[model samples]
Every structure is written in structure tokens, then in C-alpha cells.
Target: MKPQLLPRKSPRQARSKALVTAILDATAQVLVERGYAGSSTNLIASRAGVSIGSVYQYFPNKDSLIAALRERHATDLYDTLDAVLTRRNPQSLEEKLSAIVHGWMLAHQLEPDLHRVVEQEFPFFERAHQDQIPIYRTIVERVRQLLEEHREQLLPDNLDLATWMVLQTIESLIHAATTTTPLPVHQPAAIEQQIVEMLTRYLQVVNPR
Candidate 1:
């Protein structure tokens, strides 16, 4: 067999990626300190130590910067999630759900700033459908696959509905737990327990008592 060839990134593409990364790093720092309204191109340029002209060379406006940053934030989360999901062993459905939830919580705790900026500041760009829909759809599909694997245990007809319901519930709970303020003293344990309880109640097949 001929050697499989990996497509190589052009030098221009590589440089563009570097510039975009620098701009995004600068934007995140500014957003943390100054809030969305104050994150101007000049400030981002100054923080990145790049020329204002250079900043505009890649990102046409501040909105473009925010959009790129938001996409990067999502991409980072998805990448981390992919790693966790890959390592998970085939096991009880409850164990799988717990593993996924724990990984999500850990990721949120580690990158709360990026999470806040993405949640609060990023606008829905033209490419949002292209970018975001696939991520959600993939999550739904994974849940559906897991349910299929354990179909004998679950109500057969409601698999898709259950998958979507479980996904939405977990996502909403995580967002609330991570984003809520007046930070709770027992937040870490509280969130974990809440996730386990919610999922167990929804997924368990015990007949009504």
C-alpha cells in the first residue's frame, strides 16, 4: 500500500493561526478585566503587543475577535470532552453518564473565564449553525448510541427522546452550577450529587413502586 499522506498546513495558514491565537489570548484577558464593552481593538492589540494594523489584518472588527474566541473556547471544550469520552470503558450506563458529567465539571472549573466570556459575550455569528449544531448533534448521537447498547434495559420507543432529554438536563445543570454567582461553599460536591441524582432518576428502569 502507498504511504498514507497527511495534508500539510501551508506556512501562511500556520502564521494566520498563530496570529489568531495571540489575538484570542489578548481578548480573553481583556474580557476578564474590562467586560465585553471595554474590549476594544486597540486594547487587544496593545495586550497582544501586536500593531493595531496587524490585529485588523486578521480580525476585521471586535465582533470578529469575539466570534473567533468563542469558537476556540468551544473547540477546546470539545477536544477535552473527546479525550474523556474516548478513555471511558464500556460499562454501566450510569457509570458512563457520571464519567461524562465529572469530566465536564472539571473542564468548567478549569476554564471558567473562557466559559463566562463565551456564554455572556459571544454573538451568534453567521457560521454558528455550521459550528454549533454539529457539536450538539454529536452529543445527542452519543447518548443515543449508548442507549442502543443497553436497549433491553431502557424503554425502547423513547430512546431518542430520552437521549435529548438527558443531554439537555445535564447541560443546563452544568451551566447553572458553573455560572451561578455568590459562589456556594459546597458547590463542587453539590453539583456532582445533583448530576448523579438527576441522571439516575431519569435513566433507571425500576418499575413504579
Candidate 2:
């Protein structure tokens, strides 16, 4: 149909903004209930109590609408990480790692249904969301910087590689634990502790030299 990328035009007024919000929320609901393919713009408009024209005003097709949902979720994750990174570190890096574990877990758990549906309906690890690479890379770089600051605590190797590895470890596990059927780890607290231990040992300052 149409190239489903950016919105046709951003909402400028309060009423239009609210309508867009409703449309997005409706789309999320539809995705959860009917999965990705069933989340059509017409169906979303109906659930949003709006006209098909209104949905088309913002999103050209289901692809654009789903992209919006994907961006929204990514924003939530970055915002959560920002909150932790902005705070003063009054605790050990291990404790901060634990906070991050908790933050990501809670963030995904915030929309478990949507998350599961997205995983099932979209090829997130593939080309569909390739446009989001820079967004993810920026976050990875932020984490890399954080790790570099604690270079003394990490193995004296390529810090960039180490940060990337750590990120993949955490992301892969979180994705599995949250979206997979019969989760890879069911005990939330235990899993959190395990991750903390894993990262803690991996990044500990062994030699000051």
C-alpha cells in the first residue's frame, strides 16, 4: 500500500493529540486481542471511536501504526534507563546493575500482552525495525560510556566489546523471560539476583594495575 514510516503529520492541537492517543491505544488493544495482522487501521479506528479517515490522517497503514507502537515502547525503555543513569550513584555498581534489572523487568511487564503480541507479530530482530538501529545504538553507547567509566572494574580488554556483550546478555534474557511461552526464568526475584551476580562478577575490579 503506502510506505509505513513517519506519521502523515504530527498532531498539533489538544484534540488531535487526544485522537491520536486513542488511535494508538486502540491499535495496542487490537494487537493484544487479535495479534499483528488483525490490527488493521480500519479496525483500530473503529475501536478508537474514530473514522477511517482519521486513522489515515496520521498513519497510512498498519505498518506506520505498528511503527508508532514500536517507538513508544522503545521510548519507555530509554526513559527508564535515563532515570537510573541520571540519579546520583550512592551505591555500588552491583546495586545499580540490580536497579537496571528491576527497571527493565518492570518496563516490559508494564505491557506484557502488547510485548508478547509484538514479538509474535513482528520480526523485531530483522529488517522491519532496522530504522531503529541508531536509536538502539545510542542507548548502547550510553551504556558503553557507563562501562568505560568503570574500566577499573572490568577486564582490561576491549571495553566496547564488553559493553555490547553485556547488553546482548541482558536484552536476550529479558526478551526471552518476558515474551516466550514458559519463560526461560519464572522467579523474577531469583532471576534478578542471578543477573546482578553475573554482571557483578563479570565487571569487578580485580587488578588496579
On lDDT, the candidate that comes out on top is 2
lDDT tens per residue, model 2, 1-209? 43656778989999999999999999999999998766687889999999999999888878788778777777787778677556745255566677777777767777888887876776433434534645666767777776776677677479877776677677667777777743544587777788878877777656445
Evaluated against the true structure, the overall lDDT of model 1 is 0.68
Clashing pairs in 2: none
TM-score of 1: 0.76
- Superposed by TM-score, candidate 2 places the C-alpha of residue 148 at a distance from the truth, in angstroms, of 1.5
Q: Candidate 2 — which residues are off by over 4 angstroms?
A: 1-3, 84-90, 123-135, 182-186, 207-209
lDDT of each: 0.68, 0.75
Task: List model 1 lDDT by residue over 22-112, tens digit each.
Answer: 8779988898888777779899999998999887676777776776665555565566666777787638777777777776776667657
Residue 81 Cα positional deviation in candidate 2, in Å, after optimal superposition: 2.7
